[model samples]
Target: MAQQFVDTKIKGDKVVLFMKPTCSYCIMAKDVLSKYKFKPGHLEYIDISGRSDMDSLQDYFLELTGARTVPRVFIGEECIGGGSDVVALHKSGKLEGMLKSIGAM
Candidate 1:
């Protein structure tokens, strides 16, 4: 599973949301994004609880982005940081532009 997920070339409009299912922070982040009317297919949710695949993915995510938190996002191979960063970008009116630039919007 880990290998498959990692190897996956993320179809069109790449956006990944790495989070655990029960994490409120994760849920909030996703909710906020949804509230913005982002389409359902705009993001990929990788849940990391007891799943080894997720654990491995988390490790890779950390190594790749130097972040050790849930709800870390990647837009088209670009690390967009964690929930706070994402929300900050949205509040600053930069999120949409960034997404658009990356062809994720």
Candidate 2:
């Protein structure tokens, strides 16, 4: 079930941010994502804040990624850690390559 949850998110969006809508770090992540030039099918925003399974989903993420934190990010099938990681990649010019590799650019 954890794998399925991950698979669905990775396959469903070019960049999936497992985050709370009001999380400060999540907001930071969102700001970073907005700077990218993703393709048409990419979902720019999909809020998962008030879901009934929110807590369980976080648990599943801990099992899947070894981290249970908001702003858990996925690029394609790869888990890219949290907001700071994303910012680091962006600053290092690595995020663009990742986006291109996934055809999100």
Q: Tell me, by TM-score, which candidate is best.
A: 2
Taking the tens digit of each residue's C-alpha lDDT, what string does model 2 give over 1-105?
A: 545655676863488888788888888888898898788876445466787776777888888789988888888767898889989999999998988888777
Model 2 has an lDDT value of: 0.79
Query: Which pairs of residues have clashing backbones in candidate 2?
Result: none
Model 1: per-residue Cα lDDT over 1-105, one tens digit each? 554575474444667777887887788778756655455567677676877566677777777789667877777777788878778888999888777775766
Model 1's TM-score against the true structure: 0.79
lDDT of each: 0.72, 0.79
Taking the candidates one at a time, how many backbone clashes does each contain?
0, 0
Candidate 2 ranges beyond 4 A from true positions:
1-5
What shift in Å separates residue 84 of candidate 1 from its native position after superposition? 0.6
Q: All candidates: CA RMSD in angstroms?
A: 2.4, 2.0
Task: Choose the strongest candidate by lDDT.
Answer: 2
